[model samples]
Target: MDFYVAFNKTLNRFDLKAIDLARKTDLSMQRVSQFKDGFNVRVDTLQKLLEVMPQEAKRYMLTLVAEGETDSPPSTGG
Candidate 1:
């Protein structure tokens, strides 16, 4: 699954909203909304978001990302 897809699932599972995440992470609500809409964010910003997430949610998201990486075909040298 894509990062945004995993994020959305986590939010749904935890009954969280963008505003809730913004308040918890001290990030702008717009940034959270953008992330939910599939925009990329800085690594530190992502870390802050994860820091505020429930442990289970964090694990779920990580698992999704790992699974997605594993599902991709290996790259070959040109």
Candidate 2:
């Protein structure tokens, strides 16, 4: 399973949208869409996401990504 795909599910479970992430994080819709499209965002964007999530959730997200490391990197990471 793709990390971003799984991550998108997390966002969906919370009823979040790229537009909402963009608004709260002051990021462009394009950028947030890139994320939801299973793209690897800049490290800085992760920083913005970190700001919006609780520490526990952030830790879980990091763990989720790490668990997928051996699976594959997002195409956008290339």
> Where does model 1 exceed 4 Å of error?
69-78
Question: For model 2, how many clashes?
Answer: 0
Q: How many steric overlaps are in each model, in order?
A: 0, 0
For all candidates in order, the CA lDDT equals: 0.83, 0.69
Q: Ten-residue segment with the worst summed lDDT in candidate 2?
A: 69-78
lDDT of 1 by residue, 37-58 (tens): 9999999989998998889889
lDDT at 47 for candidate 2? 83
TM-score of 2: 0.64
TM per candidate: 0.81, 0.64
lDDT of 2 by residue, 1-78 (tens): 465665675575556566777788999988888877878888899689667865665565666566664335445653
